[model samples]
Target chain A: MTTTHTSRAAKRPATSGAHGRHPAKSRQRPNWLGGLVSWLWLAVVLIPIYWIVITSLKTQSNYYLTNPFVPPGDPTLDNYRLVIEMDFPLYFLNSLIVAIGTVIPSVLFSFMAAYAIVRSSGANRFLRGVNSLFLMGLAIPLQATVIPVYLLIIKMQLYDSLTALILPSIAFAIPLSVLVLSNFIRDVPKELFESMRLDGASEWKTLWGLAFPLTRPAVVTVSIYNALQVWNGFLLPLILTQSPDKRTLPLALAAFQGGPYGVNVPAVLASVVLTILPILILYTVGRRQLLSGLTAGFGK
Target chain B: MSAITARRTSSAAASRGGGVLPWLALPALVAFAVFALIPLIGVLLLSFTSWDTLGEIQLTGLESWRQVLTDPGLPHALWVTFLIMLLSWGFQTPASILIGVFLAGHQRYRELLAVLYFIPLLLSSAAIAITFKALLDPNFGIGAGLGLDFLTQDWLGEPGLAFGVVIFVVSWQYIPFHSLLYQGGVRQIPRSLYEAAELDGAGRVRMFFSITLPQLKYTIITSSTLMLVGSLTFFDLIFVLTEGGPGDATRALALDMYKRGFQANLMGAACVIGVILVLVGLALALLLRRIGGRDPYASQLEGA
Candidate 1:
């Protein structure tokens, strides 16, 4: 334990020092090649997004007649209206339910598990085993497990239900969530936990009152990442759920693309925009936290 | 370091008292075990059995394995999957590293650029595939809309172009993420190293190669592992984009599994593919970890 702690301590200052000196270091040299690539990559990244947004607003006929990059001169909500009429709102609601349903339970469970693993500090054989299991879980492609999941869902008589989607999703999310949350929880000072324990605070209380607050950013990060994954998820929903009304936004988007509305390019693009709009709004409002949190979450 | 002692002293108490800490992990354990672990085992078991989409499972020893191994489609699918993984990894790594180094700078415009760069990350794969499909329709897409005959070729209609489009679009979707990872990795490198190199009068490109690239070894492993493993799960994007069209040009293993299990009603064969996918993913992850000389997460915690 001391060895690990000391090693980590040895590395922390170097990174913090680097942070302080980063701006100056970058300013000392103008990275012309990287700058050129950055701007060029920016164009590569933005062109399609720009095209999608503008084309979605265009009338279907105007879409064919006009430049793909230009915003529609007579922008209309007619495409959006078409999407709305196609039960996009319902699909959006289904996605919301699945995201929320999956996020809450999975995050909560992962938090508890992470708190346990961190607090145990590898002393408990059970937790050590569990931690190793999750570590192994990270390497295995969980997507490959979907076929059996589909079978299990069928066996449980939960086929085609939102619950089927939610169940597998929660399971798939656990490995990464636990890994990330444990990393964050391990960062919380053990002295804090010891002090809280001395104050006669129960482990559960310390978990919620102490560790939870200290790691709120991680909680938020994991929540957003998991939400993004579940919201954008397609395979489970495609396999598990068959009813049109039960479709999530991604499924709905695909249906709209492959079906007759597929040829109605504007309407299809409208569905695409509508599906992404909520997350876009979230990104706009919480760009800083979202970006930093995600970077830290995955980067570490 | 004090936390180590604190945790150490408490561990004895924890073991003696047998506290609620272990139980705290039970819910997640159960969830993962039931849904993930069982399915993993089930995929293997089901591979030995036969089941159509609507039929009862019938035990058939070695039949599925025999079928999958003998089928030429399996090799083709595996080839496609490998091609996508290798090409995307090659394309994304350098680009991500460059953009990451660029964005690691403290510039207001870089932040703005990052904001736009991540937009692709937010969009669902299905939505992205749809947008691109329409944007590359050849008849009414960007080519025809802009009257650029060069851009107007059969982008998705032909085998080679469709394959290239898959790789290109995949890079478009994922480069931002890998870039973010690289950016974080870049920012973490000690400034003194760069300063020392600068004092030696090293050029930017020279320093990038000599210092930056070596320092980002772990990050490269991490990003590459993600790219390789994540490619196995490209079902949503490919399924939405081309549906393995243009004469099976893009029918990677994931899509192959989906087609076999869901479309063609070959559940056993699909499970065989699933097992193969799991093996390939684990093999690649382990191989990368071995190359990196440590498990990244463990090394991160231990500060290796």
Candidate 2:
């Protein structure tokens, strides 16, 4: 469907402009609108985050009396103490268990599947079909399938357990992970594989020795991505698990906000802060990998 | 014994130069089939039977569908869902593009802004909804503290304002992600096009429209598809934020399903809603792909 005119309309520049690193270095015309919107959007994003952090530090009484925009006059960790006292540590551990449980198997299996799909090189019908199945899986909303997943979990007697969360999380993570990992795997040089083949290396050996090293960054990206999804997942825990002890951070956060402690705004915001702190730390540690991987992963 | 024989035969097939690659995909395939694919079909089947969460399912053909279809709530839920999908897409697209174009600049400050901008995306929807819920409280919220009477409106208490709040919060969480996509898209645009336009004395606005907008067609499609389809799963945020609001004003289809199935104990009815949700998502995705004007099954599977 791409007409000649349409294809040429936004075609890549013929010169040395590779992947838009430095777009128009000479045409330094000031972008007033872009600048204005950038700064404005920055405020819109930051103010709430800023409010959440500072307000979390405030006493509930001070939160009521003080200028909401201003930093707390007297800071307190009482809210944090209160939130932690409410078994947040349990929820945090449950989230951690679920995240780790989901990420490892999900990433490993997806990596294996992706390697198979990429290695088949479009010649293998079964691999091609599997690849397409994963692609179709991407478009299916998780909400649509939750009902039966719930039933399956119950039937398996895995309901109300962390394993219940882990199983479904692994399935949901596979499609996107396979897509991204396969894309990365396809970029590995065919010559390398052929060279391994010449040395009488098994496909599994080449997969581990060559592709694994080359695609480690993608693996990390997929790991962090899946970790985030599982860590922040709300619905599965909301429905599958019933025990208070089995609550993940998100499900626990919702419960904390809606429970009898709901009226304690400081404690509520404190719990929110607590739930986000671990990911914030992870983000800080792997900002570039996470951000760039996300950008390139989706912006193709 | 049967499992061993099957494995032996598969290994025999694999050793015959058919390659072991296909076998490597088995774990993921089994997992997806059990938990995702089967559940998809299971949901459809469940819609034909009636079961509360704790009970034995009863096969009662189109009865559940009939009840769901007759209910006035279904239309309202669909409308609310459609409104959120449309409005959120409408609101997020332009802003994300502008900010994306802005962040595409290679300035140090813009880099810093990009860092902070993505923080909201890092927060779980539950966290974002909870934060917004507390922050927008009419009595104990920012408006009361700042003494801004206009801002002091019952944000989540009133129906219209609650719907608007839901859309705004969704945008606040997602625009960072879409803008990041736009930034990457903008970064991929050929610089020479801008150079050519510049030589012709094109202004910033002119270059953006003539060059940037057209070049970003695919990114727009990618982001739009995620936004439109992802809005269908806006359960946790809406559930936590307004619980579908004062009078079901913000009750989306997913939330409606949850209330019906989990709260009201109508599993069959909920499955019908789930079926509708699946169909709508598939239809929208196909529609967007059609608009993209590519081979329907083309291998451009780049998304989060």
Candidate 3:
């Protein structure tokens, strides 16, 4: 941090501390050691991403023979073609359906529930109880309840279907979403609701007209966050789905990697790239929303 | 007198409308009850019974629980989990704070640095694990590319070393997450304090101890709580990467539970381990929340 570095430079005797490395003349001097470490971490983070991107472009011959961390000498799009031949698009479509299916219902339900919880007067006990019930869902790890969830899906004959994945994912996603949406809704001015009520606006009208618009940012945040979670989820699909046709991208990728295609390194990397691209695009567009949403939930 | 009567009727209508308002939560409540609460109760009940994943739910009072308690490999799984949490605290937590502090500055590239670092977080854990699995290949891998062949051993091969590399990978995926937490905390420390400290000639080291750390105490608690619980209960990465191998060297409780239930055909025993995982995670979260004192962010939830 420049603040830390500058303060360090100011505090130390110029003869001793200043000469350890570069001379500090700038008012806001970068911590070179910290910068070095940060860049190294940047490299650590990027090299694999670089490897996957470049490897996806390299021929299988060079993929094994050449250094993986280096840029590809000879490149090809055939790996992506092979990945497509493996029905990567089907898996991608399934992931999209799941993400959309999960986000829409999860956000809608959390929004309405958060509205009820926030709008309920202090004496309203039933709504308060509902709020606490959702709060309790926060700590219930999916791993713990997973076996029973599988049983329930089996009982409903929904096992090995996308429905099984979406239902449980929605359930798991609600707690944090509700907590965040409720907090955001609470920040909405009460007078707006009261005036709407006084003006003979139906509760539904007021809710849709005022609350929805006011909390639209929170809506986007929860939608993107939940979509990201559903897109990236592995355990649910792994445990729930059995048929190859129903396997999500995560399951598909893992199976693709370990199957006979394991030797086809570029194709596997291509699968990885294909699976992750949408969410990466989502992150690029909604970085601030995702960060603020999570930090608000955790920080609060 | 007419105004008062009109207000009373409007207020009465408000209460009547509010009666139907609470029913809006029924969908979420039903989802929670069916998916979260029911399964939670099911896991607890199944812990005491004996059955495979299907068929008759034969209740045999503590049989599965007793078996899990007396199992030979239970301690090792737990120990591996504990090592992960400890190593994460040692490795990930400090790095997170440092990176957080660095990114908290007023520099131009801090934004780019942050976006770059979050790449692993955006991608799926399975993908990251698989890529790292290739990169750690001693010959013809990233280690070779960097010309650090001496630096690249069989990183995931040895028994003791397998668990440690898993820790590194775990930290790699998560350090950015905790760094984001700390970066938020660092930004929350008002700029004026830094200015005053700068004027007072209190060095960076002095300010970090005297000002920064004290301000960040609660955040550190939350970050540590997340790191501990998350690392302890990890499964997916290990599952895809090593399949809990070189011979149970990397099998934590979650992995062991999966293997016991699905692989070994011992669903009831798996539920018992699941119960322990739940209780441990719940206990750890609550205990950390306890140590965290009051929820400082509680006041923020009410209307501004």
Candidate 4:
């Protein structure tokens, strides 16, 4: 037994030393190569974006003739100017309104429903079942629902209205939002709830005072996800709205491409750049929450 | 105490408390029912009938379903969708995992790399499509300038290549998301596990397989399932990049559904396609749920 212990103790440092030495060695020379490869990958990824920005700034004359890699001979905002002049602002506003409009109600509803589902005791199993059913919504691709949604929107006389966009967006967002919020809520201490209950706090008070405050990260995640979905939505908006004034950015841009000036590459790129600015800003700010939120409730 | 209990009881009675919380769900329930559930039901119903937008509806039973099963357009579209999903998911998923693992180790540049990678997520599909269009343009585009002219093709207009371009664009947009998932999962694995693995004389590869891989099982399932469902339903990028293109080369099921339902006014056929999409999504989701049913939070808590 003594010999075995000694051998074990003797083996320990050698293993530890080997383990410690490896990451240290990895941390030295090879790390630089790894970093270099990462940087190269980053460059490859960023090139298309760089090209977009450059092409968007070129004038019509230089756009076709200039080397695509180099900045335009006389760089101009003419493409952006054209997009603005051509009612891109209206599309932008329409998109913003629809996205925000959808996010608010969806978040509110999902929050309360999630609170109820997480806090309620006797119906927990039922709620879980319900939640799973709602998750089935994820499986029901938008293509399947577009026709029926369109018909329903028209029947309700909501066609050509921003309300049509808002309603559908909110509906689609609820499942994921509720899923995220519920998972976050599950993490809150039961002791806190019991303490609040002893203090005569109502469910609403507990939700607003305790749960919402703690679940801010999850809330932000859901909001950003919902916003991205709403902002980038295409098929629903395409089918529901008919008028140019009601068109979202994607629809408007599609029209720009398919219009008489078919494949005006530079102008299209400019419009595309302009449209993505808001989302890019949001992503840059809230990327962590967005990503964690996406993965959190995605599985079960 | 008796007086306080009586007051509480009376207040609770006054509040109509039992229904109030359920009432809160009413707005969302109504919205979902009206906009999602009802439409879905309508689509299922409509799938069994043949109707153009302007014509009288006629009961078609399994006719639309049969056509969807056999239609040359649908089989071609399904093949394209499967191919795009296979290639894009194959390329992007592993790349995301590697990037995620790499970034997880490097604390200093993690945020910067993440931001750079995620920039595409913020951009609109239309914008990405247009940007790619300019970048891939044959004669004067940057692709040509970089001696990539050999790689250049009429991405939107070419039958053989448009699907590939669309897949690349979609993969570029979504890879950051997958990476983020894996990174989160990696962050949740206990540092002690790494130390333990090291103590066991495990090399990096051994540690990754034994410690990291087992711990990240949930994340991998979740991210891959998301990718699978997302890829199968993918529409926006393809719609903008190729518009079911040059000869239906890039026509995904979603796009095909759109064409039939709206553009061609064949609502029944579109509904059938939609049903197929739902079935696929359901199968994938169920599979993912089974794999990820274990406590995902336990790892994070242990790691902490």
Candidate 5:
């Protein structure tokens, strides 16, 4: 209930200014506190990332001997070699397979579904119902559904398969993709649809020629967003796949922490670094699109 | 013969102005039904039965719900999960808002800081967990090497600090997300509003309260809902970091669900907790929606 007042207090030191409102004194005041905290936060975020990258590069013995906060006196890439030898590339390929497998289908299906929901209004109550069903799916927590998903996969004989990971993820991603894409699709002028209709374009033709072009930004956004989710998802792969050969990158990384690499922290961290490198590259390139896409419906 | 006739009837119906909508939406609908909606319905029914991963399921009505009610570890788990959620909210929300406010006002390197802070969000929680798990180890960890021996406690081992470390890692992963929300919200405030406030003798702090915070109400609602739901269901990092160990200190509901299903071989019990989790999430979302009154972006809602 106090989310309101508690939020105000969190703003900090505004009570005195509430009455004072002294423009002159406040104008030149730099946000030193903000600056200090932000920089400190930057370090807090970077340290673990830095720790892993440096640790991954260090000679194992040097990693044991050197200050953890300092760069390694003797750098090495042997850990990467060790991880790669341990089928890290297989796991990476599996992750890529699952990611591409999930994203393409999710984006393609949801685009058609959203297009139908948006363009086929007025007596197309079925489309509207489908749209709402997808929206409700948003509230269904993934963790809650894990058991049933596991059971269903096993029932379908897809357990321990990459196809198992791909199928469920594509299903789960549809809700958000539909929501974001439909939002974009609704903004397509109704006149364009009517014009296409008069021009004798089939629903499919207008959908592909007019609506698809208009919603390309959304298509890209949903594609990257779905890719990120599928790439980073751990639970699905954890429950569905049992074999080392079938394990995705996240499952592989989790494995490195224990079992074979338990004693080799650098090797585990090397795996970590390698696992994130591709996604990090993508994020750097498409940071704006990804952020906006993730927060798409939240603006509502 | 039935399948052939059904296909012919579908073509006949489509040619009769039934439109291509159902056809266009068939793929999504099929995917949703088989994978999402059916699984959801299956979980609800499965919660009433006992089953192992490799064995036959037996219907045992009210038993799993009773088990969830009676399980000693569950309350502690729920309590721990709730505490983490509160701490996370306390940890991430205000800090995000403040940092967001600061960045919105600051001109230099704001984007750079945002990008950097978001690193944790991009990387796998498993990766982050492994890195921190190693870093926090008392014997061989960075804590020992950096000579910040004071900062070096048994991060994931000692019961009290293990929970704290979990909270810290959770915060580490999520704070940037809410901050990004705040930054976006702050950007939405019209520049003219700020100028008007300044001319009316409002200070930065005052303008923030009187104008900025008021305007950011919806974003706050949205972010808080996301964070609360996210914190409750949080699993991957905690799973890798502690495995809910150090005497069951970080046993969140999600972890408990995992244990009940896989470790205890009690699939029914896990689903009960899952249902409860869904209920709690729905309740909170509704509660926050009411508190939030009307969404400021209702126009956008209508656009969709």
Candidate 6:
């Protein structure tokens, strides 16, 4: 690919004169209209987020009476304070634990399985069959599994614990993670692995030191995808955890919003703002990596 | 110390006997078997039996299946689910493609717009549902503030409007994903193609239709299928916002399954719904694979 890019660059000079003859005037109208429409569409897409943030910052009185488009007349931190006081911190921590717990083991196990499947000799067909089986997981919607999952959790005596959340979350994540990671690991240049083998590296060593490093971006992408799914997940937590202390952020937020304590709209929004902060920060840091990571399997 | 050393040596020797690779998958395979596959089988079996939460399982044969098929609620729920899927795909896919094309050349603002559009994807669906619930509140929401109170119909309460609201929320949450897919597809086209089209005095629209859309066919099929499957199985946001209320107007199959299986403890009926959901997903997946002739993950794998 790099060679192709360089070769293409070398070929550019012969076409330079023809390209130079193209008038800027001919392109200006489309570019201007395109720019304007893109910006307008972006604004429309962002309005809900803007509304959420603005509403979160508003005072209770301002929430009901102020113009929703405008900034609050007297913005207050009371809502955030209230949410914190309501022990949102605990829910946040539970969510963090579940997300990280699910991600780490899910990635590790899937990486190993994917690596073995991709690199093992004479098993490509068998591995593809395995891959298709895992793909079936993608079709099995969570609603279908929730009852059985609940039953299994009960039978295992793990209900209302973080284990109940972590175990199923990891199970749900593994099939897709393995599918993604195996595809990625399969794409590692065979020459690199052969070179590593010539140097007397073991299979595990080659996978860990060579293939894994090259696949870090894909790993991060998969991890983030898995984390987001775990974090935003509601049904599993809703059915599995009966205790408030065991609740995750989404389930906790639902409880806060729906409870008989009367609707504290500002605080609910504040909790949302807080819940969304980690993902936003992660996105800011890794937006490009995320895009490339997400598009890894896009084209054939 | 000597015993431990000998044990470690024996284990190492055993690992060298071609068992290491299979052992590596043991944890994952076992976990999936116990938690995912076994339970799924259990649910399938349970679907054929009559069992309340408190009672013993009894073979009911096809009774539950028949009831689920004949249930009035099932058809309505199926209809709502299909409508949401159709509406979301109908509106969001074209809009995303247009936005993706429009943003392709303008690299400067592309990152910014992508970030903004992706905000909903990052936020919890429950949070977004609650936020929209507030925003669409008839009495004091932003809708009323904008004097579009006429637009402030009970978004989650009015049967006529509830499905539309759910579709909008689902589309809003996913538009970024499709846009990102299309953007990547557009980026994959060699810039030289566009330049050549320009040299031929082709308009931007013509260039896009002639060059870009064909190149983006794979992405379009993939994103549309994803959106369809996603909308079909969707539960959280609608469950949070509407609870399938306003007379089951917004009840998707997944939500209906939840209400039946867990809320009502009608295990057999819920499992029947589950089977239907799986069938829908498989059909969509097969359709996508047929049209796109490529897996969505294939490109990501190569890039990796």
Each predicted complex: what DockQ?
Answer: 0.52, 0.44, 0.33, 0.28, 0.34, 0.33
Please provide, for model 3 over A149-191, each residue's C-alpha lDDT reduced to its tens digit, 9 standing for 90 to 100.
8889989999889999999999899987888888777766666
lDDT of 4 by residue, A187-291 (tens): 776667767877888878988999999878778777877888788888788889899999999889888867855466777778888887776776667555565
DockQ of 5: 0.34
Q: Could you tell me how far off, in angstroms, the CA of residue B78 lies in candidate 3 after the best superposition?
A: 1.3
Q: Which of candidates 1 and 2 reaches a greater TM-score?
A: 1
lDDT for B252 (candidate 6): 87
Clashing pairs in 6: A296-B299, A296-B300, A296-B301, A297-B296, A297-B297, A297-B298, A297-B299, A297-B300, A298-B299
Q: In DockQ terms, which candidate is top?
A: 1
Per-residue lDDT tens digits of candidate 4, residues B205-270?
Answer: 666678878887877776777787788778878777778888788888889998888888888999
DockQ-based CAPRI category assigned to the predicted complex of candidate 4:
acceptable
> How good is the docking of model 1, as DockQ?
0.52
Candidate 4 chain A least-lDDT 10 residues: A1-10
True contacts kept of 1: 0.71
- Per-residue lDDT tens digits for candidate 6, residues A69-158, read 898867789989988988889998999999999999998888888876666532334445556567677655645667778878988999
* Model 4 stretches with alpha carbons more than 4 Å out: A1-37, A122-129, A261-263, A284-300, B1-18, B144-148, B290-304
Candidate 2 structure quality by residue, lDDT tens digits, B205-280? 8888989999898888888988998999899999999999889999999999999999999999999999999999
Q: Please report the TM-score between candidate 5 and the true structure.
A: 0.91
Writing each residue's lDDT as its tens digit, candidate 2 over A1-300 gives 111111232232333245434444556667777778878878988998889999999998888889998998789999999999999999999999999999999999999999888776655789889988898898889668899999999899998999999999999999988987887777676667767776888878978899989989789888988888888899999999998999999999999888999998988999999999988898888886777555444554
- In model 6, which runs have C-alpha deviations exceeding 4 angstroms? A1-28, A31-37, A121-126, A295-300, B1-19, B294-304
DockQ of 6: 0.33
Higher-DockQ candidate among 1 and 6? 1
- Better candidate by lDDT, 4 or 5: 5
Model 1 TM-score on a 0 to 1 scale: 0.95
TM-score of chain A of each: 0.90, 0.90, 0.87, 0.84, 0.88, 0.84
Please write out the lDDT profile of model 5 over residues A1-300, one tens digit for every residue.
111122333343344444322223445577676678788888999878888898889877787788776778778889999989999899989999999999999899999998877655524678878977886776657568889999888889888999999998999999878877877887776667767766777888878899999888778878887888888889888889888899998888888778867778888888889998998898888777777666665553
Q: Which residue pairs clash in candidate 2?
A: none
Report the error of model 4 at residue A54, Å: 1.7
Which runs of model 5 end up more than 4 angstroms from their true locations? A1-26, B1-18, B106-108, B295-300
